[model samples]
Target: MISEAYSPQTRNTKTVKLQADLVVVGGGLSGVCAAITAARSGLKVVLIQDRPVLGGNASSEVRLWSLGATSHMGNNNRWSREGGLINEILLDNLKRNKEGNPLLFDTVLLEKVYEENNITLLLNTAVYEVEKGKDDLVKNVTAFCSQNSTTYIASAPLFCDASGDGIVAFMAGASFRMGAETKEEFDEGFAPNIEDYGNLLGHSLYFYTKDVGKPISYTPPSFAIKNAEELPRIKNFQLGDHGCKLWWVEHGGRLDTVHQSEDIKFELWKVVYGIWDYVKNSGKFPEAANLTLEWVGTIPGKRESRRFEGDFMLTQKDIVEQRDYYDAVSFGGWAMDLHPADGIYSEHNSCTQWHGKGVYSIPYRCYYSKNIENLFLAGRIISASHVAFGSSRVMLTCAHGAQAVGQAAVLCKEEGLLPKDIASKEHIAKLQLALNRNGQSIPRIALNDTDDLVAKANVEASSSLKFKGFSEADDWHPLKFGLAQMLPLKANETYSFEIEVDASEATSLELQLKSCSTPNHFTPDVVIDKKEVDLQKGKQKITFTTTKTQEQDHYSFFCLMKNEKVKVRLSDERITGLMTVENKINKAVSNYGRQDPPADINVDSFEFWTPERRPKGKNIALQMAKALPIFEPDNIKNGEVRPNANGNTNAWVAEIEDKKPTLHLKWDDKVNIKSIKLFFDCDYDHALETTLMGHPEDVIPFVVDNYTVKDASGKLLKEVKGNYQAINTIELDEAISTDALVFEFSKKERHIPVSLFKISAYN
Candidate 1:
């Protein structure tokens, strides 16, 4: 182990023995997420950040926008919820900051970490020395801060090196590597023929400006590139100067970005100001009178430095082949975006790019030090070759990697095991389960027959079913529905069944059954009937049941609609000319008293298993269909309507023939509803202008039904009341329970324009 001998004077200067369950060194995105996750999991967390803010390169110091795992071209998928603290911070920013500037971003991230009860953040602090036990486990870290000018010792059961430079791992005797590896070492497509440890990608200090209105005279800096050939081409310019557009490439002779940050800063400042001067003085921006500088990132955005050594090192080849690891904990999809070893100014060189076929899973073994038992690493510091680092270094992926490491750290703490020891299959399964519960999408797995049968038979099945769509009619077939068919149901007996679909493409499947008897007089009533349930992207399911009936039924079956919508109904009531028994049975069940049934009958339990294919393009038709019902009201009225002697609105009437109606109403914008009520005119039969009331600003009109409405005390409200005949009034008690609400309606001729009267509170 690398040990630094301390003198008596050094020992005497330190008084406090700071301790925690985990110590995260670095306040960057990955480090902050790590600290938050560990802390939230009930671990005592201490986070040390060198700067006052917490977001690292994407922080106010650098001003880089957070990018996710999909296409860098603004089409990639975002990081999943298992990204943990980062996800929370992102969601908060998305809600609070509509402009999405960097200053507000820093405050939000800092506040989130500070608000955590289990976290202690140390700002403006740097770890100067790391002490290790004889067995190579990190013992303690001594950090010094200019704010105090005194060295402080922080000891923790586990340590995470998120410093981007791998400082803690390096000082604690962990093996590591720097710069590009040889092709022979990692077999990477972009690797050099021989190892070039000295030549690495440098860092950048980015800045931006807003082009307001006025023209301001300016001049280009002396160092500004006058010719097209001299300008860096890789950093493409955007419509506005408020982005990562300037490359200012540097080369082999002066490529130390971290060490020569002052020089780089000077050059970057000149470039920024020079661009503005050119736009103003050259008359290129004649109307740009009020061009104002918005933000100048102070810290150097370092891309590469040191990488820690772990039990298994990730390589670029693993990404190309779409390799899967049993211990996989994270996935990276960004291409190998490698900057030239020389600065952006090099004439013969620019940035190098290598795209991946798809996302590749990262194993937990790559996150911990090979020699140090208690030491873990995340972000750009994790064990990976330089080429592999190019792919994994993006902010969102790094955040995900940090979350995995943090969760694993908590697991290790709870189980009293080292990181390496916890890298087994069983432990990985537990970790995967935890991540899944937090909304992370892992790779898919199928279940065996025995597991499938058992899961279906249980009333509360824990598993979900899979359905694959086929283009050819002959290819359509039944899968594992026999168990459901054979299940015994007595006369007047009620049973609930759940159906889950994990198909990547929209699929049509038939639920069929063989012979059985009809319901008797003692059977319960069938109350619910819903047809055409649509499953959108990702995993979706539906549950329904017939009335409580002890009837041995027969020949019950469902035919898949060509459009792939699932139909369900609870009925013993026979339709005209349909099969019926003398002793018909239908039962009624209370909606409030029933529990949610299992996901799917005869399905297997597995993690992250989505069907191989799904319908292509946007499901616009499905979305529209779902939206149509909310706009159509049963009653309506054109003018003033009055209630009858029975307290019912006689003015409200259903005009079945005219096929057109109007609705009018006003609300307090703070209510919820299961359905909308419309007062229409006597001239129309159908309701139009289906105005809905009480909605939150953040709730999108298209996604209204996805969430449940609730009141201040979290009580569920009843459905709204009305029909498509004439103007009618609805009480707040009939609306769904919610603290906030909004109005939604359809544009039709027969609908009456709504007007607000008065809303009263139920004391």
Candidate 2:
């Protein structure tokens, strides 16, 4: 027997108190991105997740794949690869876990959060209580950790309810909507006519099955539905198919998807087991004798719940019209996909309709609470009508929304303003600058910073002014049918492209110009001009006149048809927003889809091509005038980074051996410059990759390893050492008055080949 004198106290709960600049509730893709964005901006952030793992629905527990602007390869959004952290995660997944393993993806999310030292992640911590401080602002939130029986009271100036269910907003007395709003509310053409509100999109359960090479026995439980026709969902089930392969296997939306989550999950369980019983023991599938249930998700992935209202309610009309907001911070392209009220049990298809012309913008007004002064919302909980949520609900889109929220929150904290004040003229520009500086894309918004030194000074480079080569040269191949590659050309100008052809016989090639009204669409809107030429073999140049008459430069979809054996140069490398793949007659899946059935793509071959982001700068004339991916020698300098979209190598790379490439900014007279910012290419194309045997990086270490800035007197003003970040913002110790500023950068000891996207200076 032991005495109790020396025993320590054992309490039912342990309390932890924390204070941070920002507190993000919910650890989904949106939450992770939001936390990371704010934290990376040098703010103290605390990210709290209810589940043990990060990535919310993408976590192992839920097992849903992240889908967004790419639209699961089901649509024509070929150029809509999301930029920033979302793009990083996707490319990383492609390189590392092309298999799309839920557990492996979970680790990537976990590692990203863990690597950010400014973020305080509290896993297995569910926030259930929130209190208001002075001026009815959110002050503190209380989260309980069931794993350790610990309670955490997190305090912050701002809170983000990325909970997907709007938990934080609900607890903070924020105004929110539960279901579909009437068309009269927002003039949404797709809105349900009757408006029997509260009938929401449902929850889904996913499972994976595998063949073990041996017969597996399964005893059907009493609750299993014997007949496949009972639910009508068994027909879609196939052996070895898993995850969202069975997306329609859903329920619980007609009811309260949040409060009745458990009930919905229980119903889903019965459906899953019943279907498996039909596949194995129901005598319908003898081939499944060796198949067994590998894994089934216990937690249900909720599609719609409580949506906190903001300054703006994004409507289907807004998406269809592509309404541009002055405070635009992010974009969404997934169609306005909506389901029937009955969900999977409905007689009609699971998805009733998809709206919107193409990719659309999401504004800053819809990201923050209208009534709750200190609360910001992201993910599915953002302010959108039922119709618009269908588009913005996708994971990557939500992550971008979170990125905006995080950035805006940081700006708010820094400026000491409330959530609603970010829309002012001065602060809105600051917010956009922050997003653009971090590589977040705001569609059609170009950074024309006035303080750029290169814009005012004469620029020169050591290399050829023309782009060296075409990105699609290696992708060239023979095509029996006609192939088209869109060329971006200025109106009333002539452009030429060189082709390398090896043919058994002479071929008659017909070239035609297809007009494009929508700049981003992959196919030609109409055919306007045509030309024909006879080709011999080896190498040849073809010229065409850009007569579309559009004032601003627009894409010209040019089609080529060979009457004989001829190979045309083609490179359809995947770059963001440049080359898009689409032929009117031939249609194919652009890439892998998360919803696709289980199959090893490596062993099975598929040809993918799209000159979607083809760089117009490859034309010798344009390269001489416009500055490109880096600070290359060009006539025009708008201080934009990686502005060209259609090339595999978007950044300007210096000569292989000439590591010390110096750029001179010369003006007519001495000017006072206060600061300069440099944009380097961290290899945006290679920014992400997930591999089993090797670890990849978020940024390619191919930037200016060493650099020096000098005044007209040749005196060093600022010097940077061991540089790796994508954007470098420098504040001069004192304003220097000089006619010329020199930037001299060198590669590392091993000939690193420095790359710069853009550089700007401000007074």
Candidate 3:
């Protein structure tokens, strides 16, 4: 523990007073994000966590691998990821904790807080009291430091309740609900038939094993469920399986996940210890001879508890239907996985059913307490039905909300308004803009800030866009029976659509283009065009075009369908509107469940493309032609990070063959500039696995390896050497007055192709 870093006194008689623009309660992913985001936006923040270390469930104590909307791309939600603060954690984790060592992971989170000058982190501080003033606003919070024994009273203009259990909100009398919302209550098809069952997803504990190399004797725990049969509900138990799999061990849903958190933890411990005993001591486990217990968690990861009420309570319907909200500030793509409250004791399955299409939007109204004027909420406690919560509760998804609320807190402080006030139509856009400017991914909101030169100025490149990526075995879809590919198309426009087919014989192929799933709400609806073509066995391209009448929706998603014999190309490419959807031919296998070429998961979701782009340098132009996201020089000023970090689609590409390339920026008004920040194409989606088993994401090749900044007169202003990180910045000794500035590269990293995600200059 890092307790020695602070005072060692166990008890203190005095009260400590502190003040800040924002005070975040809880140090989990949500709180970490909320605190860091607000602090980065120029607000003083006090982040308090009850634990001696950080990263709640994902901490060494619990050891749960962080999961979110993308579900690790290869797993599901192919095109999804929690971009802002959560992504930063992933990237930093890639850089520092590639081995996935829990202790090192803790250090990364702690160091991040320490690096943020605007944040004051107070560890082992448990908040137990909240002060409320007129209009139900929070005045301050009182927390007791366990080690130092000092009571800290932190007063701030705004407060964020990321305390997994909504402790701060509960103490402040924030309205909340426990248990499942009735199916009719929110029209959640996934809700239990019963009205309001308090049964919730349970708590779970994890254990790690090490190979002793030599056989070792085993000792059985007295409380071990010796005959694994005692827990028949848990099937396919294996010593080799780990990480969020059912075999990791879970329990306690029948009991209150919050009020009985301790009791539930104890029960989970019994289950974990017993399982190990059964694996080692019972005659059933011969493979356990060489494996020994390396570590077991003392703390259990709690899944559900008190969910605070917000302006809009997210319902299962919202997730299944992919509801669009003008105030949307975040999104979640994890399936609505609801386990029976009975947990291990019950005979029911862990999850009810995986829900509809890829990632869905999360509105801003769900981030703040409905009645608590100053209380904003993040993490598992945010307003969402048990079913929807099943999906949003994932750590990375929670981190997304944390970023939204953090940005909103900045707005609340700057505008001198309440959370509700910021929710107003007038101010909501400002909040979104702030989030966008900071690189948070708010689904469906194209980064179109006027300050972005790409969105306003004329853009040109040295070459036309070239598409990269080979058509591998996993790069195409067999469009037959029930599969379709979503293609974003313009209204009343006809464009050539190509298909790559590998048919064994010249089979008659019937193809159709249909609208997106909604309103009609099913695949292959409102056919825009239909054609029947004969195909050959080898790779062949068939181009078909269709024009929609103006009567059709101004812009609608169209899907391409083929007969059973046809196969369509599924590029690893990232295109603005290329999504995939399919109907399950059988209940056991969902189109969304296919990972062969994850981009073609049958579920109606965007193709999950990790680091969603081609390897750098190879597709410098073709991917650009496919195009908008091809890291055009305009993207530098687009005010958004590439949707997928490691991918090239959302990045601009350049080849360093002859003279090093240069990017020149000119302003008609000639404004004074003080600092410049450049975001190189670091391949955010470049497959970064948090384990030593895999390799690190390439250190983005296009980073300004060595570059010089010059004025319009060609005079050198600044020069940087051997740059390798994603973000490189230089604050001038003093503000320089000029309408134009130039960044000329002397040398560029060539390990991979060069790419840039974004660049920003500020006064």
Candidate 4:
């Protein structure tokens, strides 16, 4: 076929006009979350991405692991993983790709967005221009797609700029900052000196390697750094280390990370290839002979660029002090981590981090532009000082905050309001309640949902867990470092704990009872009592009694100080609200048992009592004086869905022996229930890092994999199998009028009990 048109001046690509209730201008984790949440909340949405796939930094291109409050279980954020759509995504990834393949994670994000009918996903579309309406409102966004050579004009009432560089906000003339703030500007003592530390963090590139079963050869290009073996960070490179493990291989801090990304990529490639050459040619790594480059990132993972301004800028003080916000919408626990400006080339440490005693709340005021009326800020571009961005810039934290922005967009459309209006006193609670209803956990805010019919019904389970404590010893955990058993205790209650211990020699063991200054926090800063017990050489029982209770309910730490000769018994029984943490060092993140920075740094000095990963982190076996009745059937009607800081399980857990556990709900009058929402326990303490981390199990052991719902006559209403997600919503073909409902569950694992957080029925 011959084409016959050499017509006029120039050919114009096709231009498409799209409209929706909300327009999301990025396809990163945050933007993907925002688009999905808004669409699920009944908003017509348009999702535009500059890249070929979703999950910006977490995508296959960048290969960064997604993490949030759990912080790799390397900190004191017990059961503090993020919730909502991001939680769903991570759990889904865990179920499908526990091996954490970046490509598989890409399909998960794509499937989630594609399944939502309200979302119009446009990939490889870069938004370059913005149209403004009256009173500084965004009217429409104009983007061009090089893949298809088409222009797209997407118009919506509200817009969210989760683009890492704040492209939309920048083009719309929004207020923003690109570099570090002065110490005097935000009273941040951890602020870096712009000259020595550099004002901005840099970008990072990662590569993966595989064993080819035979010897392989590598020849670097002429552009590669020839003397990579002489680099300052040469010692950090290991033979098998790849991807984010080699996160120190970075560049482009002195230059503009956005405008000079290509320069950074070239430098990173040179360094990466040069490092491979050194591994092959140098005599140090003999084990790398068979290792071949499996994959390498095309684009560098950006750490910082332009952070748009909103009504309030989060500062280091807020994170360090664990400040509460009136309009708290989300939370973050990643240490205030900042990278050296010179990146891998610097002689200084690759990064510096400081952790707060507990997780801190993120306010709604930091979610929308201060001047741009319709612009919603999310991701790393949210309003925050450089000191705060070190913690909030992580992908999961950004996605958690974006879930709030998504719900706020829906509220703005419904109430005929702007983004700023949702943070006010009258509207903030509504927004928070909506977020909680959708599985987003705001630190102290419980969802006081009055519409849930389960709240009005009388609930009774076949059997509820009585906290007599796990006495079945599976192994003996030696006291290499300080170990503590975290138990939720009742106020003014006398409790006695009997622990089995083996001492190598006759020695005195020091025991302490401690609790956090804040009742709901996990930080054991306040000591209630201390005692020293004499022990013999052989195995024996060590008992402690405590009647000194706090003014309110809280988690008590039964701490056994570091004793090299003592070994305590550990139970394999894993419960919903119980755990044991040790005071030790995780050098990977620079945690050295305790943080004692210079007093002038304005950061707290505290020990990091973190939990060990699975197949190892077992609870201490003990016998309680009395059974604690915290896990009652009524907990299913409570608004709280996850384990809270107060140590309340917020769930009804069946006894381990109750094989066919069933819950019965009785109501006075028949109620119309078209849908049912169930919340399950997913072990939030486990950080489901998206890539390069192998999980012990595909489905969290605590989740109820098989369950069935029955109506008054014991007729099956709904059945679920192999469920792994935390939130499950079941919609019936038609509403059923029933005065009673019965729920039967089967235990997935023998050691882990079946538990349900909350249940709701809607007409």
Off by over 4 Å in 3: 1-14, 74-78, 194-198, 246-248, 446-460, 466-640, 643-651, 655-659, 679-709, 716-730, 744-753
TM-score of each: 0.59, 0.77, 0.80, 0.98
Q: How close is candidate 2 to the true structure, as a TM-score?
A: 0.77
Name the better of 3 and 4 by TM-score.
4
TM-score attained by model 3: 0.80
Superposed Cα deviation of residue 578, candidate 1 (Å): 35
The number of the candidate with the highest lDDT is: 4
CA lDDT for candidate 2: 0.68
Worst 10 residues of 2 by lDDT: 616-625
- Angstrom error at residue 609, model 2: 11
lDDT string for model 4 (1-763, tens) is: 8886788788888999999999999999999999998999899999999999999999999998998888888887888899988999999999999999999999999999999999999999999999988657899999999999999999998999999999889988999999899999999999998999998899999999999999998888899899998888888887788888888998888889899989999999999989988999887788888999998889999999999899989999999888988899999999999988899798989899888888899999999999999999999999999999999999999999999999999899989999999989889999998888878888886556787899999999999999888956759989999999888886777678899999999998998888887844687877887789999998999898875776557887889999999999989899888889998898776688988887887998877888988988899998888898989999988888877767687889999899999999999999999999999998888999999887998988988999999999999999999889899999999999999999999987878889999888987
Prediction RMSDs, each to the true structure: 19.5, 7.4, 6.5, 1.5
- TM-score for candidate 1, residues paired by index: 0.59
Provide the overall lDDT of each model, using Cα atoms, as 2-decimal numbers. Answer: 0.51, 0.68, 0.66, 0.90
The lDDT-based order of candidates, best leading, equals 4, 2, 3, 1
For candidate 1, lDDT tens digit of each residue in 1-763? Answer: 8987876664544445579999999988899888888888899999998897888887777766665444322111111122334554655564455355667778888888988999888889899898876668888998877786666789988999999888888888788887777766655556742333235777765556676566554455677544432355433444354544343323332454445666766765655555555555655556556666666656567778788888888887777555788888787766566665555555433555444434577888989999898998988988889888877887777888888888888899999988888799878888765653332344331112121111121111111111111111111212221112112223344444454444445654433222222211111122122244445544554544444343343222221222323322212111110111111111111111112223331111111101111111100111001111111221122111211111112232212122322222323443344333222222110011001111122211111121122244445433332222122223454535444322232222222122111112221
